[model samples]
Target: MKPPDARHSQAEDARLLTDQNELARQEALNGLRQFDAVVEMVEYHLQPEHRFRFRPSHLLHLHRLALEGISSYAGTWRPASIQIEGSRHQPAGAHRVPELIEELCDYVNDHWQECTPIHLAAYVMWRLNWIHPFTDGNGRTSRAASYLIPCLRAGYLLPGKQTIPDQISQNKKPYYEALEAADAAWSERGTVDLSAMENLLAELLARQLVEVLDHATGGHVTLPSAKENPSS
Candidate 1:
């Protein structure tokens, strides 16, 4: 098999590409693979006798699984600075990644009870993006981490036909806006404000619950104009 095209490389690794069409195809396949992985991980954690502890290693492993075939630096932090295209936010310096990620893990584990599930999930998603730890697949990994938050907190995997990550992927504009809002709050006030992201996630989870319920009852339910309440 020929080496995958690297004409649109996004990182030092030539294997990471930015070709929209190819990237889209790879992402679709990767999303499915990651979905299965999330289910398995959630199930394993939910086992009656198992004790689940949130760890930075889980996020690293998720990143590895998410970009397994596309990026050579899938599970590793970037060795050089990265510029997020079209975003004003600058991620932490490469040298600070380990410390930052350790801090994130500590925050999540320590405050797991103080915060709501949506708040916790949104924080993970935004903080991961802000860190930009990996050379690639940071968004996917963060989104997966977001999903894992609620599951781990609930002590059971949440049921849904369309997960929060899937919803975020379908229409990223609002997701980006929410993340940007959180970023702005952090930059200006030196505080974490995840209200926007939490609201969006709450909406997505509600939609997922509705969809799952519809399927469970064998009913084709359609809500009011999706524009008024976009789920996808």
Candidate 2:
């Protein structure tokens, strides 16, 4: 059932960071905290007895970190419908968010062993954006969750100076294109064809790793093509 408060007014949901400059500063600070927290959480969950299980709470916690001082809606599912700018895809209704997020977690847990790290990460990134569960920080939370899944699956944090999330944020054209590709596939058929997104992750991950190697070797290292890296 749609909750009585499911139609939050735009004015009521206005951000706490009224100043654009302050908002940008907070975004930078919050992003650091969010990334550090994700790494720490990944380490904690890596313990043999404390295996990771993707849950709705995980997303909420990450969202909270991403928008703690920026939005009044931090740490919670959006209470009203939101429209994605520059795209035709409509987010799931506020009433459907909780169930959709639950299913997303289930998808990760159900295929934890079978899916490649890149595939799992790509799926999480795309699906969470598709769900658009939070009133704010959906992108931040989605990217954080995407990084978390692969780190947990691999049993350790992945190494890189610039992570997949970091790269995507720096220049989002390719990222948006990949997401659009997946959306088009879903519209054409009921399948989750994440090849484009998967490929994007694979490429960015390789670039990140190569940067690490270049720094480690003092610019005397040879790197393999992204396609050659089976780890992605």
Best by lDDT: 2
TM-score of 2: 0.90
lDDT of 1 by residue, 1-232 (tens): 1221111114566477578898778877887888787888888878878766678788888888788777888778888887777677788778999999998888888897898989989989999989888887888899998899898888778888688888887888788888788888899899999999999999999998988878877776666875685555
Cα-based RMSD of candidate 1: 7.5
Which ranges of candidate 1 are over 4 A from the true structure? Answer: 1-10, 16-24, 218-232
Displacement of the residue 186 alpha carbon in candidate 1, Å: 0.4
Worst 10 residues of 2 by lDDT: 1-10
Q: What is the C-alpha RMSD of each candidate to the true structure, in Å?
A: 7.5, 6.1
Candidate 2 residue-wise lDDT, 17-44, digit = tens: 8899999999999999999989998999
Candidate 1 TM-score to native: 0.84
Candidate 1's error at 204, in angstroms? 0.4
